[model samples]
Target: MKTDLKLNVLSVGNTSTGSRSLPSQFAEPIRPDLVKRAVEAIQGNTRQQHGSKKEAGQRHSAKLSRRRRDYKTSYGHGISRVPRKILTKRGTHFSWVGAVAPGCVGGRRAHPPKPIKIWAKKINDTERRKAIRSALAATLVKTLVAQRGHHVPPQYPFLLENKFEAIAKTRDVIEALEKLGFNDELNRSSEKILHAGRARRRGRGTRRKKGPLFVVSNTCSLIHAVQNIPGVDVVPVHQLNVSLLAPGAHIGRLTLFTEGAIERLEKEKLFMQEYKNLHPPVPPAPQSPASHSKLQNPSNTQKQSQPTQQKTQQPSALQPQKKVSPTKAPSTKSKPASQMTLTQLTK
Candidate 1:
């Protein structure tokens, strides 16, 4: 069965060229549970393992014995039976301070983090793939995109022509986005706020809102051009994951897709290979009688299409062809075949 969803294909000028059917993955149900699990797994893998050293805060020479008459004993002392370090003392009488305990100063932590602790959360391969599809589907929902706090164009799931990948200039990319009705979104993402509390002190000093994500079929100059733009990200279709699509376990992100990316997604059967095997893509509809006639009468159609076909039929005169010339062999001595050029060997 054909999907009811049809995304408008936008030209380089931000004009709608036509429409294309979305991939089956975009039709998957939004499963927030799977999305959150997948995102947590991804984030978990990136967590840096950290822990206090084994000797940290426990290197002091402090020692105390509760046994009566033992050396450095605290017996008969008013203080509790805790380890104590000597400060200053008189003969047979000592002034001690608690040490090597959680309540004491410069003491080891009660429950310090351990390096051996496993930080990564495990997820099934199928569940991770499903989460990616769910997140991808969420991007197409206007309400979900809005709920995620993204300022989006009126048309959700923005689709751009394949030509959009060739964009090499940041200014041109910005202009195209503005024309596509994302001026407000661009402005919104541009605003940066200082991170609150310790996070600011630690490396993440500022944070910016995530803007529209551009998903293309392959790497291109556009990736470099958009890197400097605040909050804007360019990712290849194959590299798409749940974390990028649904940051903080929240579904829905403003996403822009190139026509080539859509084609790749379907052809590769990404994230929905199992479902695609059950239902193959529908074949193109039969051409109309009038359209069939136009196809049959190629002579008439060729005359009308001559101008567009000329570039392919003839090579450009501006590009000069290179010429190869025969070379004369040296009379002194014959060189090895490997050392001689083809032209020199011919002589």
Candidate 2:
């Protein structure tokens, strides 16, 4: 006997059950652990590296000194009376051992080594597939259960549906949803889908392209769409804490076209237009003169006539040039503090 799991078509939130109008297979109970593992695996696969810090050793040079000599006396003093045996260099003091002579103690190391993780874990194929399926099932079930029993804001809905119409472009997606019996008003902008949560890969292909999608107006429509597709999962954007939407029923493409839905869509468009008007205009892109040869060099016909050129250059020619005087530089005689101004003395 084919073991029957009544799967509470409605309780499961499949479109066939009427909770959501999307695909039907999504209306089953999904395991949370499986969903979590699937998400983790995807995240692991998409993990980005900081890239190696090959220049870290060079950065350490800024923190340490680079002097070779050790004594301060090496720099000739004003007086010759100082003993030649005195071992001071120009920059270093008597106490400084670094500059005393050729063979001296070395300075401290600029950078020290630190410990960090360098390896990532690889998830098994069987576990990944199981997790994705579980997450989708959980999402649909939660939506069906919440529709009547629990109340939440329409704008901040319980689940965020990410539909990939299999048919490319946004218009086709909207049409598909309408055909599935959802109202146009129920559909939100594509931007909302990105904000709510990102789409998860079905694991078969690395390059999964989104055709066109929008949020389902009713939970019934949403579940139906999800239940149909394999490997796809949906969960409430705000709370990853709950169920997942399942896909296996092979639900067909959806579209929206119910009564009064057009009016709602117009209002949404108006609101978007008004919001766009409030934003400042984007500045024009900077054009590269070198890339366009015509822009760099003007036509000879447009050049100023010889008479006009002479007129423009006359004033510049007549202007008297200032002669830079060869004033003798001041001798290096030290002035007494009393002779200096208050500012000079303070400095």
Candidate 3:
């Protein structure tokens, strides 16, 4: 648990509202193996099942006999004892030709498919949840997001305010993202990729890039606003899975979360089944019980030790000169006390 890990919260206008500590959901270790497994399972479950017709070619008569005294027998004939249809017959004599069998006309299939076959794959609930956490953690890393071909600003890993969920117009959303320096990312995700294969014949060969994902606490108008944007997806925070978090089993999907969504994830323990006990929620602060790791303080209340610098300037009388120091600027780093203003028991 990175109790000191704080991220700046940016509004839709690209201005920082305040800093917030990341939830325990992002504290998980990156386990690519589990992520890949979960993605494969999801892919398997989504596969459309199909097979050949049940009774493709079984509508012909091809019965034959090897008896010498029978009416339609192949006895005393030079042909082998194979199933066939009788073309013409005489008393104790028969003329026949092969039919109604594999390699013959109108014969049943050698091996046909059945609809009963299952195409879905199984994954344990525990492993699935762990994979989700791992993927979630990967999203906060700047290098991974950049390596995945996403255009990230300097403040790549920032949280979103609840105000972002209220935008209901695509034009306004694009305008807000532009203000945040995401024009390049939007263009990158808007391009169409054409693949050359039989899938093209089905009119589905063209695909768009997978871009930013918006996770909200509740269903809002933002879902409808970003629906038509190429490669962008809006999903409820509770519905997060390996597929959305890490598309095609690849890590580092650029994600945006509303402040309410972050609180909900922590308060409800959304994707932390295995590690839920590891970082048990501390006693809720008297001001707010809706907050989880964000609103709590460290157990040890000892003050942080500050480093002091000793002056080594030689103010000797030889030159009778005193060196002047430039004015120092205040530190921009946010402290735990400053972060308390973000979700202070009120929106």
RMSD of each: 24.8, 29.5, 33.9
255-295 in candidate 2: lDDT tens per residue? 22121222232233211212233357899898776646656
Would you give me the overall lDDT of model 2?
0.35
lDDT of 1 by residue, 123-184 (tens): 99889889998998898889999988987777666689998899999999999998888898
Which candidate wins on lDDT? 1
lDDT of 3 at 63: 74
Model 3 misplaced stretches (Cα beyond 4 Å):
57-113, 274-347
Residue 154's lDDT in candidate 1: 77
**Which regions of candidate 1 are displaced past 4 Å?**
68-71, 274-347
lDDT of every predicted structure (CA atoms): 0.87, 0.35, 0.84
- Residue pairs of candidate 1 with colliding backbone atoms: none
TM-scores for all predictions: 0.75, 0.30, 0.65
Query: Cα deviation in Å at residue 98, candidate 2?
Result: 18
Compute the lDDT of residue 299 as modeled in candidate 1: 81
TM-score of 2: 0.30
Instruction: Report the lDDT of model 3 for residue 64.
Output: 68
